[model samples]
Target: MPVTIPEIDYEAVFQSNPSAILLLTREFDIAAANRSYERMTGAVGAEIIGRNLYEVFPGGADPKKAPGPARVRASLERVLATGRRDTVGLQRYDVELPDRPGVFEPRYWSVINAPVFDTDGRVVMILHRVMEVTAFLTQLRQAHDHGITATPAEVEAMEAEYYTRVRELQQANEQLRTAHALEREIAAALRESVERQQRFVSDASHDLRSPLTGLQTRLEFALQDASDDPQQTIRSALKDAERLTEIVADLLELARLDAATPVSTEKVDLAGFVTEELGRRVSRVPVSLDLARGVIVDASPVRLARLLGNLLANAERHAFHRIEITVAADEDTAILQVADDGPGVPAADRDQIFERFHRLDEARRSDPGGTGLGLPIAREIARAHGGRLLLTDREGGACFVLRLPRSVSTGGDSG
Candidate 1:
């Protein structure tokens, strides 16, 4: 009796594949390859079909090899014998193609393999599915080849073995660049935090020391007076105690703000906020407002108010008598500028003034804090809200501009 052939879907095999496909007989001859396979390998039906695996491009001379080991023939033969599948990294091989510029270069492949069965249910072919991972592998090869420990000959051999992988190399470089930027930012942030902490400690120490010294003097005088100075001494001691308590309170507030790193913001009108904020400064220094109404911003009202309030306080402390305030919002930003008539920031000190613990020469006259943490804290808040604070050096006085983006602003424009 004759054996009947079982129906198999040939169209679902090589021809229907989205990727390159091929069919090879048990003897390692190309029975067929799909259109994608031809395009991927840059080989034709006439050249590849009916050809032995090694006959066309033995030893991987061509850029793409038909499902076989280019470096180790013995291993591939074993896979064929066992009718099994495998995967490899960075295999340098070639396929014969029409000569184009630099056609001599060996194309590398990241590949996987499997076994195909015949109609008789016996293993008849080895299948290959390859992905190009050249760019990434190229960097790995270069890093390995040029290692500090490698001898010249070893380096030469490794380079010789290196197959170019542009994509992987570019990807790795970009990732490294991003990581380096983050590292630098983190390092700068850490340095700023340390300096701010130091300033807080120093200022508080000085504030405490003054009161303590005064208390000591009062105690000594009271001792000599013997009951005559009791009232004065008690009052002086109470004053010193209050000063110390205030210092402690300030320190606690700083610590609390730092501990709660990320704060939520509510959408609040910028114009109204500025108007209310400026109202407090009313006439202490003549103030002008050009606030555009209906512009809303996303920020913890408390933090944003603190930021604004500090700037206003600075102006009040330094201004010759008048301050100008303006508010505006563009497509994606809300801008607020405050200018005063005091001695403007000198060009040399503008950059350093924002640094934690940095104080301008004039800043000391306005604030004993000369603690220099206000600007830094303001900056931190701006960044947290996706915005920034910049100081402009103008002749009339120092103008400080705060830029808040739409992400932080709720009422930008109605249209």
Candidate 2:
């Protein structure tokens, strides 16, 4: 007769293993632990399972033992990164006493961290094995003191080696922290960029709806032969189409500015530039100019011209009889003001007027051709040039002021 042995239960073997054992996820969360581990740490299975490994065994305040946790973390990280086994010959990791709150018991450990690989040879989890060596180390120290088995020099050498390893682990831990901080910053910046893109899309869709709907309605009526004046209907449809085009163009310009593209700049004579720009465009409202000499600005000529054009167009729309343009300079600033003797902006609407696609009730009633983007575009140009545009209080009508950083004077009389 042949004797037979029953098949081994591997789970039971792991649970009953003589050494302390913990199974951890790639993220260092405790997936499971054996009974020996529970006995060694003086913690229950339910308390540590599904928690972070470090959270279960945090670093103690003792300066001598502080590096123990860092060493363990570094070893685990190395095992994960290399998919190979790593051994920490000695460590003084302290565990909290189960019965005593905030009290820790000094413990010495010999640790082995190994990869738990799946069928595809990918490391799925870490198998952390530890042996408590406090008694062995204690015995060796006692023997060294009493001239027994070990010498004083041997014990000193061992301690020096342990501290050396701790220093290396501490350095690696600091590097890991730096890398994590950089990752967080990059993630935050990406999130903000995505949010800005979302807002831009939302604003574009909202403002485009009105003109699109009007164009669709007019075309649908014209196609149905419901119009008494077909030619007039066609002209009105063309006008709506033109307005849609302008809105789209303005939106694109804003998008370009939002992308933070660098602007080209050169020194510009403020008074001369204003005179040249005003000469190109004739305003319906009578215009007066008060030009001051030696006002220079570092600016992009095309963009500055657009800013001035927008201000003039806005003034022409609202001015009842007269518009005044002024150019002057102070110690560090070049100032330009465009004032209109029209009904001044309401106190509540002054700031809102510079928001994209915002228009006042009076503006809608006065100028149907306005796209409501002029003031916003002007303000953006001003900001892009390292300047600001603001509505200042005036006795009558609205006063739009642009202030830019003044450049070194290339002195000349006003052109």
Candidate 3:
């Protein structure tokens, strides 16, 4: 016969071995042990397996213990004396189950004890096949003693971090107060100083215009004979003079808008305002209207009118002969939508359209797009009235939507 060695799965063989195998001396001190024997003692097989059981579980072996080591050992001794396997009650078995995460709660179990026979057929091995109630029995702590020990030295670090944040916030608040006080002082001084120069600024540019016009005429005539290409000189001179005149006009308009306080608070009908402005501005475009009525907004009438005019004018300048103006008013808000039937604004370029000095239509760039201030001025007016004008979306051409609060907060009126 051919000789062959049996293959052994060493890991599985140890795990499924029926008993807690322990090599203990006549004095019940462990010398050599298998995996199960270490578990029954609650000691690792390598360490306590070579040590005395009495020394290892001194307090653990008290019979007074409901499921104590002595009680467990007493039952095993009965099986050894008889050389017959015997069972322990559920009370003792339930106390000794293995543990792992997310496993079930332990219930009750029956344990069997026996002795392993050696080569001489003498009982030389102790075997404890302890049953499990459920594998999850060992998860929680058995019994724990706890007391809070507080010493002042341990708390110093936490106290310092709390105080540091308090100081930082205090410093930031102090700096804000200082800056606010300085701003108020400077604003008061500016008002007083400007009062002295009020008349000079109001009339100074108009006063200079007479001399500038005369000088411009003289320069134009002098340059007429200064070069043979006199037409070029004349055109340049005209352009500069026109630019100066436009600047003066802008300054005068800005001064007026800033210097005047709001004169009256009235419920100007936005639908009527839009209708009238569209008539004046959208002459070239075919306009579709969904005009909403009874939407009274709180604002300066002149400023409001200017805002609508600019929105309508912008739509006309960019559209392909057709535009839709939709006015939606509810109890809370009024949404004015101006949609053009031209190629809509590209998604990437929509944000740039409302920026100052931005003109999306290249063909109208030569007209200077009314100084590139129409949309910005419209936004300013909308903000002053506690409303906002926004360009919503442009599919092919664009859709501009203006959202406004339905009513102004006044001192007495509830609505």
Candidate 4:
């Protein structure tokens, strides 16, 4: 007797496979789904099969506002038209749970759609495969909550890993055609993100290291001279610590400004505000105020005060004998100017002066205590109020002009 051979059942293998998979007709209607797909979507085969893809998984809360359906349909149509496989990056899809009625759970998936052709070389069905990556995204979010910063190198590695998997999948499905335009766009965005992260890290590290290095050097010198007055050494270390604190505070302020934090705005009396602020500061330079009365503007008082203080301090540091303050308002904009009697900023250096951590050689040599963040912070504050602070040309010294919109008001003049 001849031995009998058993026939292979490929349909049974597909139905029992662990990976979530769906078979769709040429019309994009679900034809069959594996056990894993049914479990993943919490839908019975009887309920989902023979239904349109979008009908089964409605895109988002608002049909008109969502891009999910269009994106998925486009990929499927591409596979049907070209008889090739298509891979999509991460997608956000919320699913309704069978156990919980009227409730949808957020889910993310990486999907691949491949064509299934007939004997005549015509596509008849689509094989849709999905891998759930919600847990991986959740882990990344949790790491952010724990104050873990991702480096540019780490981001590049993650992007490379994603494309490597995509390449492998394309190789496995030799008929797959990669979307070159989408790939180029993603690469450009990732490159930009990496560049921004690198610049931030470099600037932050440089700013932080300067004061720390000074503190270390001071401590070392103190240790070397045991007989010298310990109080003076302690005072010097305290000064360095204070400087570090100021740098950290400025950095925080810059971050907040960059984030566009909301500010409180109110009508401020310009003349009185300037008078009160000037009274608080004591400088050897002769200060003159030529303030116009009834000059008022809508601004955040705290921010305005800080801006003015920075300008005044800068002028005082550079002034040889006199510092002048002027306030005037026209029909549309209010103008405030601060002028000093020292060397004016060079035309070439004026543009770079407002950059964070930037300092002129002469300014640095004269004012060693300056953290080089004051002018930048002032400019940001000015911009936050829909205004501008500019370095205007002056004959004898640097002149800073602050322009702001005039607020509606009625008041008396105070010179």
Q: In terms of TM-score, which candidate is strongest?
A: 2
RMSD of each: 21.5, 13.2, 24.2, 19.5
Local accuracy of candidate 2 as per-residue lDDT tens digits, 183-301: 99899999998986786677778778878899899888888886458898889888889988988988877877777678788999888899999889878988999989778988999
lDDT for each residue of candidate 1 in 43-136, tens digit (9 for 90 to 100):
7877788997666545344424433355324334545756666445455565444686334445666656567877876677766566654455
lDDT of 3 by residue, 87-202 (tens): 55443322222343222222333456667787876667665555554332222221122232433443344444444564466456546756976999999989986883574464
Residue-pair clashes per candidate: 17, 0, 6, 0
Model 1 vs truth, CA RMSD: 21.5
What TM-score does structure 3 among the candidates reach?
0.42
- Candidate 1 structure lDDT: 0.69
Lowest lDDT block of 10, candidate 3? 136-145
**Between 1 and 2, whose lDDT is larger?**
2
Ranked candidates (TM-score, high to low): 2, 4, 1, 3
Ordering by lDDT: 2, 4, 1, 3
Per-model CA lDDT versus the true structure: 0.69, 0.85, 0.60, 0.83
Higher-TM-score candidate of 1 and 3: 1
Better of 2 and 3 by lDDT: 2
TM-score of each: 0.52, 0.55, 0.42, 0.53
As a whole number from 0 to 100, the lDDT of residue 402 in candidate 4 is: 97
Q: Best lDDT goes to which candidate?
A: 2
